[model samples]
Target: MGNRQSVVREAARFAEWVLREVGRELRVARLIAGMTQGQVAGVLGTSISHVSRVEHGLIKGAGLVALSRHAAVVGLKPWIKLYPIVGRPLDRAQLALFAKFRDRIAGTWRVTLEAPMPIPGDLRAADALLAMPGCQCMVEIITRLADFQAQVRMAHRKQRDIGASRLILVVAGNDTNRRAVRDAGAAVRDAFPLDTRATLAALTSGVDPGADGLVLL
Candidate 1:
């Protein structure tokens, strides 16, 4: 309940910030176009006070149609862009890459796809879990690696929570991911000591790589 409330509060704050920014831009455009609040309101068939409130971002329920009308009156264009939400559902490419990794490791070890975390009520799950005679490995597969540090921290947290003996980060062997790993350099090395070759060798041989590994699929 607390977590949900916190998320709602954060979202409200972000929406307020965006509204203020948009209002500021509209105010500037109106000024540059030599239009008064009254003039804009007249064109939009609304009152000057309503226009003032909208421009000041004081009207929390200002609709897009009203905003667009105001922008049109001020010789400005209103547009919105959508971005992928953090931890969004996997796309086709990502799912395919996961399948490839699963096939590679399934031959040698017991592989569980989308294995739940050990902690009760924790919705998060490891992308894959690999088990051998004396080892349990938690795996995170990335089709396109972004925010390297955040990914590392998440992997570590999952490993600790699940009490896995080993952790492996499997990424698609594309040039983009390769470059990302290269740019990360020492940080990547420090987190996952085993490189592609060594990691694969250990996985195939059912041996604990002795440390966390970064494997390219």
Candidate 2:
């Protein structure tokens, strides 16, 4: 219910932004065509106040027909474009690195890719989940690290919500990612106490790491 309400609110905000931009464009078109609001109202068979309201994006609720007419009078065409929501695209290098990591641990741990969060109605999912006798780990794989703090917070949330015994961030061993981890320094170390070597050893041995970890892939 909360997620649905948030989506509705976001949609409303985006609609409001689009309406305001369209209104501005319409006003600009009228000015470019050397026409007055009264002239536009006359052409559209509407009142000057209605035209003014539309131009200001103050009119609301089922006004598409009126808006279309107004747009035509102002010598503007209105259309809609749709796009799919998608995650960040990984490059070939990242894909190859991820595959190698998967193969390395495939023999020891039970790995689930794109593991859904345990909470019902939650759309978010972990990059991977690894399980064995003593530990259940929620893992996030980052080929390119941006906004380190935000990523840490998101990982923490997933770990808590999924009730995993440990959280592991598998970062690509590129210079950029390495520098980012180095710059983060103590914060990274504190959040993920176990080092890459320790984390890998634990996973290979099917033992509990006993804490959160950051592994360089």
Give the Cα-based TM-score of candidate 2 against the true structure. Answer: 0.57
Clashes of each: 0, 0
| Predicted candidate 1 versus true structure: per-residue lDDT over 157-196, tens digit per residue | 7888878989899899999999999999999999988998
- Candidate 2: segments with Cα more than 4 A from true spot: 1-94
Candidate 2: RMSD to truth: 13.0
For each candidate, give its TM-score against the true structure. 0.57, 0.57
In model 2, which range of ten residues has the least summed lDDT? 81-90
Which residue runs does candidate 1 get wrong by more than 4 Å? 1-90
For residue 184, give model 1's deviation from the true position in Å. 0.7
Model 2, backbone clash pairs (residues 3+ apart or across chains), number: 0
